[model samples]
Target: MVKKQDQVTHNAKPTAVESRGGKSTIAIKGTFPEKYFAKKATMTITPAIKNYNGEIKQLTPIDFQGEKADGKGQIINYKEGSGFNSVQNIPYDPAFGKSILVLNSTVKKGEKEIKLNEKEIGEVNMSTKRQDIDPKLVYKNQTSDGTNYYFSEHNYIPNNLVVKTATIFFDFNSDKLNWNLPFNQKEENKQALSELFPFLMDYDSIQSIDIEGWASPEGELRRNQQLSNNRSLVGKKWFEKELESYLKKQSKETKSFMKRLTYKLYDKGEDWDGFINALKNANIEDKDKIINVIQSQATKIQKEQQIQNMIAIYDEIDQKILPCLRRSYFKISCVENLRTDEEIMRLVNISPDSLTKNELLYAASLTNDMEMKKKIFSKAIELHPEDYRGYNDLACIKVAEGKTDEAKKLFENANVLKSNNDVVLNNLGIMSYQDKDYGKSEKYFNESQKAGMDQSKNLALVKDTIYTIDYQTKPDIEETANDDKTKKQKSEDD
Candidate 1:
């Protein structure tokens, strides 16, 4: 008996091959590499001998120096020969789209050199008139490969830059926090605080602690003042609670010993401790001096705390910085458990609510996760919509999502409630421009510019729009094509 023959056909889908313009042309998995670089492009880096920290400074450049076998270590190519030499000119390809080709290098005091790879192709050097660009580009600098270089990658920052940093780097304004935390968590104040916990715990000698809060020189004086106070208190309180809790988990003897002689807390509730302490330590080793210091410090700290309490209820002053301002601190009383105290405090400080909304918003903005930010800001808005800051913050999320209409309305509401708010006006202009309403955009942008907004680029953008409008309105190919086909034009010519 003849068996029925089975028929089969291979109708597999094609693998996708990316086009130059960033789209898939065909589909077939094995035909394409798992990943490919974006088209390479050239960029020029200029070097100059500028006075750096009162000394003639030059850029120490290095080539790709790692072993080629490491895949990442290969010297793809250098614009010129590699050596410790003055970089007169170097051409290199800008990082292959997002793929960075980093060359680790180092520099010496009073030494200057320049190096180039296939990525660097040009250089322009000028006087310190270009200081602004340095701040914009050189958020961090580093040294590697025997030369000084601006760190283009986050991981390279600490290794390259050197400055007058305290031994306790992360201790308030110390350079320690400059190091990038795990998973970009450094941008998150809470995460930073969270990370700070273990550090504090490690320090067993810290029997007392003080946290002073500061504010940027913006916003209402009263609000800023109150915010700084709250933040100090909250920060201290969190640290104390966390330390106590952690201590409670220790051996009974340890816990009892720590409790009896470990905890001492003080929150000047504002930025008054330093000033009062200075006055107290003002070279008078007498009781009168101590009394004066106590009186002055007590008065300022008490008044600041009272002001913060009032501000907490002031709906109109609902700045997101309030929580940062409303911070309390843990001041360890005795020298014992100081290490435990610090560790516990750091852990407390790192908790989710340890940071202010502004900090969270700033951190969220750095990540690719709009949903996370939206989830956070959205809830904040719902809880505090009447406050200008909450609405403004929510509007920022809307803007990120390309919801111009909604963002514009929100900005308008924010502006109406807080007329002096520059962020609302600036964002309103941004939304208007994004919506292609150049006229409205220009108006808002001008208002922002006149208000001394920090973003000079916005003013330039408004001018660019005006120029674009002029060029677009001028007769062009489309207008000529319409004229050529129009009967009215032909009749008028005849």
Candidate 2:
């Protein structure tokens, strides 16, 4: 029997994740390109931030960044929050058959509008901050003005598309993140650091952040104090140096920077007030004299009420707040006028899913631009051949542009790899229909239906079209025999 924990289908593909607690719900509905369905996926939640303490009631709102296409999308909204809990769902590609998720927690708000299909959803109202309007939606070969998902040929279908949302906790002290060593002192960590620095640099727009270093009280008080202080200084320098290097690589044209990067360094030497006090009550340490001494110092620091004095008080609580006190981070401020899509896309192709290499190729066919479609399709084929989406998508482009012979060859290749995919069967049927081979067309159409490409209405339309082909091909019989039979029948009736 499968265990309760096993119900999540750890090995099976995941579509999305859900919040563990709290009643807030997430609803996702989006459209895909015409005649296409997304592959099975395992959705992983990456929590970027969390507020377990429940001290903060609301998080800052910010636009969550995601791309339907591998590299051809943008984050064009104004507000995403920096709240305590932010969760993202990352999907993997089907063609590559790899499992991956990039769930991140952000301390931001979730109300941001994206321009899809020239309509907007999840957008904030202008007069009031509350969201009041349903933005437009665009899906494969169709657009929704708000009430309907309409196809290009004016056909309408129910808005059956739904997206799953989940909340995940992002581990900060992890040895590795997203298969990259986040804090390791190796090549993997270097790459992780590289990724981190870009986001950290963005925070430099803030006034400054406080950097307090701490060391366990294992040795002499004075020695531990200085050691902690030195460590903070080292971290500050590393951050500063990395920032400078990143700025140098930005662009030759920019001569100015937004905010000055700075940090305040402090060290709390050998003072385990928080930890030691807890231990004292538990009789783990019989150091009344020591506790008394530390309490006096803590009381004095609390009275100061200055930033420097606060650091001292904060240090006193490090024992009780091991996670917060041992942490090293800087406050970053938001800036206006960030880089454009053309600029970011220039750096790398934004993948639809980290695990899915083939899906990126599937996205290539979605591109209407011929040049881009060819480039993405080639990359997809290079990555994986076991999957038929790549071959079929590329073949689709051929059929769209009237390259029937080339499309037929591509279909043949795809059939060899996967005989059951409806997409390939449907395309093959359409190709045969267009080629004026009525018998071949009927065979392909039947095959498509057998393969579960069962659109009765579409099949009916195809059947009607066959009559047009017959009338064109058998013009002599239509012009002579059909007219004589009709004339005889009418004369008899009269």
Candidate 3:
């Protein structure tokens, strides 16, 4: 009996398709009817790419043949195995929208050859959807160094001078500034007083003078309170006398030019806080017990009694700690010589090295022109190579100019200078995402967030890209099932 054409069937489907580095490999599994064996049977599979422009390109084909049966009229069954398979690698282009895997099978019996089946096994999306560059990521503003001082409507340029502080030790239980005492006779004390004289005489106006008087915690609370107040008053009087003497020595024009100075006095009675702070650094025994007693004591009298009972510790405290507590702490705040904007602009162009790192950074912020900003940042990095802000800001300029590779290198250098910098990490993530490395980009974005970067927008972009790539690579179960049903019906009709 002759078998009907409808009794023989062929099936072809792609097992998997893997894509990377602008290339893809498609693996196909083909099946022939168990009872349909011929002397010579051949299967050919071809891969093709359809680009967005509707252009189609054919790739190399894969061919496989079945072995002939032993004798004429001998029925050999084709077993289910990997013998009917085809593997082809095709060049993947980002511009291409889809990759098509085509399958064809033919059978040769006696002197006649007949086609069996021809179908498309599967198709995968080759196009990649890239997200738009985030504006925030492309134009990161440089961070401030927090050294710029603002006064009134003008920016105060630091003269490289720090706030000056002076301490004056007093005699035991005494509040007066004992000028004749040996402690006060030290050269440091003389220099401190002399420095105060010139500061008042030279500056047109002093910002403020804070006099904080502290007394040892061993005495009665009320006595200690009065003693601290008296010490602050006496310290203020000494400064007043010194200023008067200095002004008397100054010319009349100098006195006329000086502005009225402001002063504040604070009586910090019983320097208990300072005492505890000192004990933390002290190497004396029973330090923990002392600290515990001090913290646990509810009243000043209780604390004083507890400390007095520790007589063995008192000698050390008296010699090492108490002397330092019986003193007045004073700080003088003064206005620094400031530069005008005109002068800063001129100096930035002429002598950028003269400006502080903060000044150079601030100068960059002052201008809207990209070229000027770049020049200012160049000078800033030249002068302060150790500071990562200069490199970070320069990288932002590179990004805005579409020099992404250069920006990436700059960000890497910045990260080397300041490891785990939020801005540098975020920019690196952006570069990775643009390169279609979604996993690497996600890793970088997460790290940037851990480093304190505000990466919500960039993270969302990465997630969207990942979803797009995943959907493109893996077929949906429902869609694949429907496709199988359609192919089966078509095969049966044929």
Candidate 4:
């Protein structure tokens, strides 16, 4: 908006606002008319903008002194006025759309002062604010875009190898695993055992099963050794029986997991460490003396007698302490059954419902085709409507299509599903930016960054609008904006 009044002539009348040198600027260039200045007169020129809400933003004023006037100001000649070029950068605000720019001038000579009529520079055009940043998406592995921008994605399952451990306990002086005993009756043991079949049936490939059995040092060393070995053998046999039963129930098409399974059995006889730890932890009568007698005694028979004597003195050692020493442990190593890229792509279109949510999202990520991504995301939302990932990712697709209205609705839906989510908050920020609501967009980006998604780049982009001037200043230029700055700004973007 650079058109000048009848009294003023401008270098150029820019129709649109532009971003240059990473700053949003509105530059005006012109010169005062010759013989316009009085010998003892001082003039003040002010530029301002009237926004959509009728609020005015006044820029820093420029001053000029007459030849007879004192002070360090641009001395205007009485015969020939000075040239000027001003570049005033202001952050982009929502209300800046269709704003008007005006110049105010005043002159003071002797005891008299005159206020000139307001000059319309022109309507400031905000067309340069329109930009497509191509916002990064959600639900995937977050990556950097060379400029420290976090590009969020959803296909985060890099590897599915897992080592799961489950524990089962036994009864006092028993080689058998008693299901009714409180130790053995824990739901975790049953849950852990039950989980193995399904993983073996389809989900994962069972690599190895490590089983360990331990017995308390209450019996003879040789007897405890045999007991530990028998208990571990029982655990292996029971697991194999459970696998066989599951195999009978499943379809023959499923792979035979037993053939793939490798068993490593360890019989840890006489848990002396367990006994000492239990004794140290227990709050019992003569606790110190009992531990000393057990740990320092010479013979196993003597230690057993001392333990028996302590058991008589305190039932805590026999009931609560000893039960924990006898136990069976298992470690199951498994690798997830991952489908190939070709398989996922074929199944995504043919029978999408059969694919899992992660597989569908991964399928969408595999292709550069937007239409394919749209189809995959559509199915993801359809099959898993409750998941926010599908909604957010589908909205990103709509945004890429320039379907802002549709994208906004989907983004809102994602917010509803997972309130204050970082990825959704960032997308919402972009929506606000598109709607010309920079203030609201800033708040959302700040929240997004705080919530773990980095939106700093977006924040700076929204706040700083760059402006550049390719044309030279006009003959009417009265003042340059940055007189102290000798070097001109040339942006890489220009």
Candidate 5:
């Protein structure tokens, strides 16, 4: 086949054909105009095959001579037959079913070179047919959730107060707190007092203190009231003296801390409530009868008289309950400070163990780098295996990495730790959707929505996927009808 200028034409028969191998040699002929070959030029002809997929396979490159100036100052003309006539062997290739010949020519004079127009000079159509290939879905990385879980700092106190109460008893009819009381002489009382002394000295360490004083019920109503009030005053005075002594021994910084301290005093007169509580819990005989008498009596004096009349159980009451009534109760609450964000971040790298589980999880959320997030989350899970946030966040990293199975397992583990975690459930739903488990995906999405997760976008995506699947699988009735009508018309025409 030969393509003339601005037109393509084919000869009736091949120039030469090999009988044994069936390889055909086709002659390609073309001529350049005089001005085109005036300069000393070089020409190259390349034969190639173009496949159905738009890829080209080269056959062979042919070089041609150019016009050159002779020693006699005359031009040695490059004739058409010598420079443009060439034959190319076309081989059988399933992919290269269509072939073409391209011509490229360059002109050179001394150091200057110029490229001529490259042209498609010839074409051939082979007998082979092109094969069909199936298309596939290309996998793409998904965007991150951009949601972060931070550790709550405000109103969050880490240290819990170890509650210790010290009770000092008073003798019957006495309003003063005896320093030499038997209860005060006990080792536990000394330990309790020791635990409370430091908090009293450092105002920053203590939140508050409550002092309550009580008197036994077997007394005059007015006398008992006066006794409870004086006992509360005496108890408060003793603590104030102890605090003053503590401040005297401390430096100015600690002495000044007393300014922030707060104190509350309560006078529990007659201790009737304490008496009823003691009676309810006591292991003595006629307990129900004593409780009934106390409940039935309308007046405080009548109750006292009824209690004093229980001569058999009076010893039990004096030894077991009355001493508890004639006493002072001191309750001290201490302040707990939380670590700052900067301090927690600094320690996370150097000493991660120093940070709480929430702090470690929060550190992961503070950075956008995936590798750093993975490291922090790994450390969080290692430190606190029971917390679900660590597992859920780490699973997000796995999902971004295209490890869907690993992400599913991590999400399941997170779910086991904290059942129905919104983030975990949402991620699992996404995984199921990606795997084409539509029913399972819908189930997870519904559950996630119930768990307070925003699944509107995810649900929309699932609906779209279902529609696409249905559309692709459904039959085309119009196309089938048209095909049948065309077949019948062709039969009638035949």
Candidate 6:
């Protein structure tokens, strides 16, 4: 009976060992059981791959013979057994993604021979090629040892700036909606409002709509003060009515989530500052004097009085400037889960520019396709170059794909865009851990834990994970499975 091979290689634990220069190898080394071979028997051993498709491909075979056997090959001492080492690599093949390494052997003496059952040695899985890199990232930076290692976990969710804003003006002292007002009719305002309704319809995504009403400083103090308050109410009422009407036309399913729309109103009374700003920019008569008069006035009444004086005196300030100051500004900020994954994916592909940096990052999570995520992150980097997420994220992809050189560049770029960012720093730390650079790994992990993005790197990560044999072990642990090392250890002992 053949003794089970002692697997010393940790390559069995998966970190996605990428093939280099078109070469892929599976090596085997183990001790033959003491006296397992017959005194005059000779044996031949061959290793093979039983692939996912149920096909077997045989590799080169090596021969061993007992001391008394008529063979001129590696001799097996029948009393002590023996340790053998063999490494066989082939050109990389995608079909080898999910396969089994098995041993095939024949024991022969004289004209009689016996073929043994193929025994599974280990599994070969290349599925990690689809890894998002950081979902398992390779820290791109290199230490004193070498530039190889991977680190990443799918823990962080990017925070997005979901709020969008627009301003629509009202006539001074009026609380009514002004359809024809130029500020209300501005194309940009229309564009802003255009997106507002869809969010309101999906009301769940809409966090809140805040409308702030303002009045230019003029007329009776109390009246002008109350004007903004009334304007806010008027705008609120209009949205309530508009949304109600819109919901009335929706199906019950669509209407179910539209039960209520949250509206917060604010009265930012007396745009005296706005009036002053208008005064400075105005080329009308007594611009400087008007500014002086308004600034000199201590009380709101006096300021209102000066504004009235100016209104009565300068039609340019009264008709043109005051109208701009008296307006309602509204903002609709969305919640974190604003868009559906499908919508985000569509936007990522069709109009990535339309997405915020956070949306782009989150969109990468919408699909399992690595290339799609790379596309999304690339767009984020292009549109929001100042942001670190894009660089850190794309670099992670690079690392997972065994493109450490590219990963290094991107992570370095991320470090530059935002120094000591927890997510990026922690990734660097994990890379260090992978490379057994414990000190550097801890420093980075601690910096990340105490730094931003609310991440905490576990210093005991490798030790803790190394115990699992999780379809794999830590890279350090995985090294134990190396055939060459196992073979060398025996050779050294002998």
Index of the highest-lDDT prediction: 4
Encode model 1's per-residue lDDT on 244-279: one tens digit a residue.
Answer: 666566423345444534333242323444433433
lDDT of 3 by residue, 322-357 (tens): 767888877887765566667788999999988767
**What is the per-residue lDDT of model 6 for residues 1-494, given as tens digits with 9 covering 90 to 100?**
43433321212232225543454555567577675767787878787767778987778887888888898668978778878777776444567656676777787888998787656667654432211123333332323222233322333343334777767678767888887987778788778765666565543456778998888877776786688898888877776666666656664444555455578899988887787787788888778987888889888788878777777878998778888878777788776555666777788778888876666776776667879878877887889888777888888777768786787788878888888676777777666665566678678778876875333325544323211111322343346668678899999999
Candidate achieving the largest TM-score: 4
lDDT at 59, model 3: 66
Rank the models by lDDT, top first.
4, 6, 3, 5, 2, 1
Residues 1-494 of candidate 5 have per-residue lDDT tens digits of 01222232212124533222434556655545433443454444455556557777676665544456322222325443222455656665545555444555444455665665555544455442111112111111223443222221212244545454677788888976676766667888777776667755443467677888888998788888888888878878887777777767764455456567788889888888888898889887878888898779898888888878874556878666776688777888775445666776688789998876766766665567888778887887898888887787788787778787887898889889988766667667767776777678778888888988677766665554210000110124346668899999999999
**Per-residue lDDT over 344-386 for candidate 2, one digit per residue giving the tens place of the 0 to 100 score:** 2342265433424523543443445766765665555566677
Name the TM-score of candidate 2: 0.26
Candidate 5 contains a number of clashing pairs equal to 0
Clashes of 1: 71
The TM-scores, one per candidate, come to 0.28, 0.26, 0.51, 0.64, 0.42, 0.41
Model 6 ranges off by over 4 Å: 1-161, 202-205, 248-258, 280-289, 338-494
TM-score-sorted candidate list, best first: 4, 3, 5, 6, 1, 2
Model 6 residue 306 CA deviation (Å) reads 1.6
> CA lDDT of 60 in candidate 6?
83
Looking at model 4, report the run of 10 residues with the lowest lDDT sum.
Answer: 469-478
Q: Candidate 1 vs candidate 2: which has greater TM-score? A: 1
Q: What is the lDDT of residue 35 in candidate 1?
A: 18
Question: Could you give candidate 4's per-residue lDDT for residues 1-494 as a string of tens digits?
Answer: 11222556653354334555443566677677777766787878787777768798788686877889864568878688778777776555556655667778777777877787777656664434534464544343545452221223554363477776766678867778688877667787678778876765554557778888888887778888887887788888888887787887875433445676789999999888889888888887678888887879899888877877877778888888888788777778777636778887899889998887778888887888989888888888889999888888888888878898998898889889988788788888878887878888889889888889767688887876544322223222324535423334534335
Compare candidates 2 and 6 on lDDT and give the better one: 6
Model 3 bad stretches (over 4 Å) = 1-99, 102-118, 121-132, 137-206, 220-263, 273-303, 311-324, 335-355, 379-387, 416-420, 437-494
**Residue 458's lDDT in candidate 6:** 54
lDDT of each: 0.38, 0.40, 0.65, 0.72, 0.63, 0.67
* TM-score-superior candidate, 3 or 5: 3
